[model samples]
Target: MDTQADRLAGAATGCPYPFHRPAPLEQPKELADLRAEPVVKVLLPSGDQAWMVTRYADVRALLADPRISRNLNRPGAARISKTNKLFQDPRMDPDPPEHTRIRRLVMKALTATRVERMRPRVQQIADELVADLVRQGPPADLNETLAYPLPIRVVCELLGVPVQDQQRFRVWTSSFKSISGSSEQNRLALDNYMRELIETKRKSPADDLISAMIAARDEDDGRLSEYELHWWSRLLVLVGYETTAVQIGGAIAMMLAHPDQFALVQEDPDLMKSAVEEILRWKLVGSSVTMLRYVTEDVEVGGVTIPAGSSIIPAADSANQDESVFEHPEVFDVTRKDNIHLTFSAGTHFCAGAALGRVELEVVLATLLRELPNLRLTVPVERIRRDEKHLLESFLEIPVTW
Candidate 1:
C-alpha cells in the first residue's frame, strides 16, 4: 500500500552509510556513530534509504521480531545491490507455511548428527589439502588451495554432486555470490545446472541431500514442490560452499593477524573450539552488512517509529562489536568464555548450515595447527586484498607459508 519513499517523504535525509571499508580488516568509520544511535535512517548502495539497527539487543530482538519479513522482492523494499539478484530471488523471501514446511524437511536432512558424521571426511579433506600445499612449496594462496576447495568438496559430497564436476560448480557458486555485472548470467547458469542435477538425482537416487529432497518432493503428500527443490538446492550450495569457504579464510587470517592470540591457540590446540567461536563473533564473514528485512507493520524499534512497508537492516556485524554486550568488544581474545555473537543470526531464520560451518572451521584450524604448526601469512594483513565486487567479504588471495 505504502512505498518506502512515501514513508520517508517528510523525514530528514540522513548521512550516507559507507558500505566499503577504508581498508581491509577495518570496520567503516561511520559504524561507531550509527551504533550509538541504534536506529537511524541511512542511504543504501542502491540509493534507496532504510532504517539501520546496530545495537546488540535491538538487533538480536529484531531478528526474531514477527513484524519483519525477509521478502525483499516487495514493491517498496530497499534494494541492497543494483546488479545481484541473490536477494531478489523468490527463494530468499519464502512466505509463511511454505517457509515453515521447507525448513522442517531440510533440517531433518541436515541435522547436527549428520554433520558430525561428516567430520572425519572433512578432516581428511583438510589433511589432503594441507599435504598438497606442502608439496607445492612455500608461498601458496591458501584461499585457492585450501579454503575454497575444502568446503566445495564437502558441499559437493553432501549434495551428491560428482567429484569431476566440482570445479565448474565452484566457478558457478562464485559467480552466484558476486556483485559484479556478470553475476546475473552466472546465477542463471547455476540455476540451470541445479535443475538438471535434480533430474539426474531423481532417476539415480543416492545418500545425499539432493536425493533426500527429491524423495520428499515425490511423496504422496508432496511436501516440497519442484520449485522449492530447485531453489533449495541452489541456496544450499551457495550457503554451504561460499559462506564456509570465506569464514575459513577469515578465521585463519584473523589468527595470523593477532600473533599473541594466535600463539595461545597454537600452544593449546584444545582451544580450537573457543578460537572458532571467537572468529565467528569477530569476523564479518559474509558481507559488510547483513540482508534486509522488510517491515510488515508499523513497529517501534530503539524508540524510533518505522512505518509499515519500510526496509530495515539489522546490522549483525555492529551488534557483535557493541561494547555494552561485549566487554572490550574490539579486542579479539581467543579464550573468551562468555562469547555469544549474532554472526549466524538468531530466531527462526538462523543459519541452517551453522553447525556444518563450525565443524569445517574447527577441523581446518585444528588440522593446520597439528600438521603445519609453522603456518604464517606471507604478507602483511593489511596487504591482503578484499573482494570489492562480491557480496561476500572474502580475501582475493590468502598467501601463506608453512
Candidate 2:
C-alpha cells in the first residue's frame, strides 16, 4: 500500500489547487484527470489539504457516508474559503438530528404541493419580466431583466419580504459572495435584518413561509428555537435567491450557446423537462464541491485510506461528467435519458428547494422560447463577463437580443 511510485505520480501531475473556486464556468481539465485517480490531495484556497473525490460512485458514497460530517463547528473541519467559514449558518452547516429537525420543519413549509401551487404566480412573474425585457428593447442584460428579478420576487413574496427591500438584500448577499468584503460584518447585518423581519411577522403573521415558521415556533412547544428560526430564514432566502438566479442565467446561456440543442427543444415543446435536467447536468455553475465534509474515521475510498479529520470534497461537476454513468457525457443533449446528475446533490443534505428551482427553470425556459423565438446572445460566448470574486460560477451580465 506504500508504493513510492504512486505518490510520485500524484505529485508529478501538479495539484490543481484553487481551480478558480469563484469563477470557473467550464469544468477544469485537471478535475477530469483527477477522476481517474482514486483520491487526489488538493490544496484549497484556505491552504488546507483535502482529498478530492471525483468519480460518480465515490462522490455519491462520500455524500451518503454516516462518518462524514457537514458540521463546521467541529475542530479541524475543512473549510472551502475564509468567506464560507465566516458566513456559516447553522441551518446549512449542521449535521443531523439538528439538521433533520430543522429540515423537517422547513420542508413542511415548502412541501411539493405548496411549491406546485405557486406555478401560476411563477408563470405570471415570468410573463411580466419577459414583457419588460421586450419593452426595454434588444441588447438587454438578461441577468438583470429575467434571471435576478424572477427568483428574487418569488422568494420575497413567499417570505413576505417587501419587494422594495430587494436592493438592500442584494447588497448584503453580494458581500457574502465577495472575496474582498468583511464576511462577518455582512453576515451580521443580514442576520439583524432577518431578525427584524421575524419580529414583524410575529406581530402580524401573514400567509407566507416566514409567518408559518413563526407560528410553528410559538405554538409548537418551542420545536424551533429563536436562533434556529433566524438561521432557517436566512438559509431559505440565500438558497432561494442565489442558487436559482445563477441556475437561470446558466441555463439560458447554455441553451443559447448550443444552437442545435436549442433548436431541438424549440421544435418539440414536450422536451422541456428533459431540457431543464440537461441544463443542470451540463452547467458547472455551482461549486465544484458541494460543501466540505470532514472524515470522522479513517476510511477507504478507491483503496486510499483517508485519515480521520481530513477534509473530503465530493466533486459534483466531475460526477455529472462521469463517462461511466453518462453516454457522450460532454454533449449537451436535451433528450438525454437516464439522467441522474448530482447537481442538487444527494443524501441527507440534498437541496430542499430542488422542486421549486426546477419549476422556475422550466417556466423561464418555456416562456422565453415561446415569447421570444428570436432570442440570441448579444455578445460572443467568450465575451460574457464572469464574476471572478463571486462564489458561484455566475455571469456579471448576460446581454441578449430578441
Candidate 3:
C-alpha cells in the first residue's frame, strides 16, 4: 500500500520525529531521546518543520498557556498536512471570543448532567455489543464487533443524528481525520452532511444534543452563529466517536498484553476508574504530538526561546510517560495514583465530550471484563496490523476469541 510516508518526496528520517512508531503498541522511538533535549526541531509528514515538547511539565504548561493559540491559519504557521487543511481550516479553529462563545453554548448543550443521565443506556449498549459478539462466536474482530461501533452509536444517539447513517459517518470521519487522504474533500463532505442534519433538526426538532444546541442558538440570538453551530456539530460528531473508538481498541490491547494489570482490575472492579486513567495515559493514538499551536508572542519552552508565530506540538502521550511526573513511567500500572494524563488536553481547549467518553470506556471495559473473562487475542501482538489509512494509530482489526 502506498502510504503518505512512502509518497512524500523529501520526508526526513532518522529524527523519526513526528508519527514514527517502532510497532503498533510502541511509543515513538525518538520520544526518550527528544525528552533529553526537552525541545527540538522535527520535520512533519507535510515536510514542514515545528518544535515538539515531550516533558510532562512542559506539555501541560504549553496546553494551558494563553499565548499559544489553536488557530493555525496564520501566515507563518507550519502546515500539518499537504492535502488535509483540516488543521488550517478557519471554521475548525476560531478566535478567542468566538471560541469562548461556542464553548459556552456547547457546555449548555452537552452538559455533564446530560451525559451522566445516559449512563444506563451506555451500559445497555455495551451489554448488547458483548452479547452479540459472543453470539457470533470467536475469531472475530473485536474492533469491528465492539470498539468501533459502540461510541459511534452513543454519539449518534446523543446528537440526535441517525444511527442508521453510521456507515457513512464512519467513512466520512475516517477520511476527515486521515493523514493520508484528501482532508479538504472529506471535511467538506462531513460539513455538508452536518449542515443538512442541522437543517433537518431545525424543521423538526428532537430531544438531543444537536436540537438542544440549535435551541440554545435560537434563544440567545447570535450568541452562537450559524457557522459556529455547524462547525461545532461536525467537530463533536468526529471527536465524539473517533478518539474514544480508537482508545477502546488500544486500551483493550494494553490490558490483554499485561494480564497482571488486567488481573488487578478483574479482582477489584473499583479499580476501573484509575485503570481507565492509566489506559488514557498509556495509550498512543497515532502521533504523540497533537494539533499544532502557533505562539502568539515570544515564549520560553524548556529553556529554548520560541519567537511569536512559531508552531509547537505539545506531546501529551510523551508527557504521560515522563519519568519526572510518573514513577516507572515505562510500566503500565493500573493502580498508579494521581494519573493525570493529558490525553484530553488541559485548559481552555480541554475536550468537551470527555465525561461522556469516560462513561463509554468504563462501561465497555467493565462489561467486557465481567462477561468475557477468558477473552484473548487470537493473534500475536506484533502480528496485529494498524489502520494506516487514518491519522490515528488504531488497529485494522483486533482478532480475539474466548
Candidate 4:
C-alpha cells in the first residue's frame, strides 16, 4: 500500500475527483475520477481539513491502523468540531484510554450473548408490527411502519424505556444528530433530555442497560462520572437505533431489488444470514461519513504515503463494494462465499451495537419474510429513492405493497 505523502503534493485539489463513496442510493461520479489522485482533499465550510479515501485497500488499512486514532479529542482536531456535543463527549472524543473505557462499559451491557437473548422479543415485535401492515394491505410505508419502528422498539426495550415514550425519545434523539441543526440548541436539548432520563432512572431503576450501567458505575466506587454515564446512556439509546435503522431498511430494499434472491431467502430461512451480510455490504449509506483522521505518524495505505496530521478518511463504503474481496461484488449475491465485509469494522473500535443489530435485523427480516410471503415493492426502483444527503441513508418513505 502506498502512503498519501508519496504521491504528488498537489493531488486532491479543489475536491479533485471529489471521490467520496456515495450512499447506497447514489454514487458520486468522482469516485472513479479520483483514481489518479492519492485521496480527495477539500476545505470544509468552516475551513476545516478533510480527505476522502476512496480506494478499498487504503480505506481498510487506514481504518485499522493504530496511528490513525478514532479518538477525535486530540489537540488541533478541528475535524470533529463539525459538531458540538459529538466530539466533546468521550464517545467521539479521544481514541484509546477514554474511548476504550467508555466502549468497555457499554459493551459489558451489550454483548453478543446478551443481544441474542433479545431475539425472541424482537421477533415478537416484528410479528405484531407486520400483522398490522398485512391487515392494512398494500401501499404501506415500510420505512415508517417497519424500518423506523422496529429498531426504536428494540432499543427502547434494551434501554428500559416505556414503549409508549419511543416517539418523544425519537424526536429528542434526532434533534442533536441532524447536520443542519443549530449545535447549541440541540446540545442543550439533548443534555436536558438525558439528565431527565437519568434522574427518572435513579428514582426508579429497571432491568435494562441504563440501570445496569448505573449499577456498574456505583459498584466500581464511582469509576463512571455523572456526565459520562449520562452521555453514555443518551449515546447508547440513539446509536442503538440509528445504524440499525439504516441497515434494516437498506437490507430490505436490496432483497426486494432482486426478486429471485428475495424469494430464495423467503424459502430457506437459513439463507437469511448470508442475505443480511450481503445487504450490509452492497448498500453503502453515503451520508454517515466517518470524519477524516489525523494521521499522528506517517503511514502507508494502498501504496500511498499519508503525512502526519493529514485528514485521512477511510472509505468503508468503498471497501464493502470492492470486487476482489467479494465475488461479483455488484451482483448482490445472497450466498456469497466470502462475505468478510467491513460493515461492523474490526479491532478495538468495532461497533458495540453490531451483535444487537445483527439479531434485530435477522429476527425482523425472518418474521417479515415468512409472514408476507408475497411481499413486493409497490414503487419503481428509480422512484423508490435513496436519502443520500441525510445521515440515515433512509428511503424518505419505503412504499411497499405487501
Q: Which scores greater on TM-score, model 1 or model 4?
A: 1
The reply for model 2, stretches above 4 Å from the true place, is: 1-14, 18-25, 86-93, 180-185, 217-222
Q: How much does candidate 3 score in TM-score?
A: 0.92
| Whole-model lDDT values for every prediction | 0.80, 0.79, 0.80, 0.67
Residue lDDT tens for model 4, 106-193: 6766767768889888889898899988888788888888888888889888888876777776666654544443357556776787
Please give, for residues 1-402, the per-residue lDDT of candidate 2 as tens digits: 743323522554435454653322466666566666767777666656678777899999988888888776667765666555444554454777767777777777777997898899999999999998888888888989999989988888888898788767766776665544446767788999999999999899988888887766423435667787888788788889887998999889889988888899999999999999988986547566446788889989989898998888887877898999999887889999989999888999898889999999999999999999989988777777777566675688888898
Q: lDDT tens string, model 3, 1-402?
A: 533323331234324346566777777655665677666666766777777787899889988788889988789787766767765666555557667777887889898889999999999999999999989898788899999899999998998888678677787788776666555666678788889999999899998998898888535535567887887787788788888888888888888888898898999999999999988887557775455788899999868898897888898877888999999988888999999888888888888988998898899999999999988888788777887656676778888888
TM-score of each: 0.92, 0.92, 0.92, 0.87
- Candidate 1 vs candidate 4, lDDT winner: 1
After TM-score superposition, what is the CA distance of residue 175 in candidate 1 from its true location, in Å? 2.3
Off by over 4 Å in 1: 1-12, 91-93, 181-184, 217-221, 286-288
What's each prediction's clash count?
0, 0, 1, 15
What TM-score, to 2 decimals, does candidate 4 have?
A: 0.87
- Steric clash count of candidate 3: 1
Tens digits of lDDT, candidate 1, 121-216: 999999999999888889899899999999999999999999998898777777766655345667788888888999999899999989887766
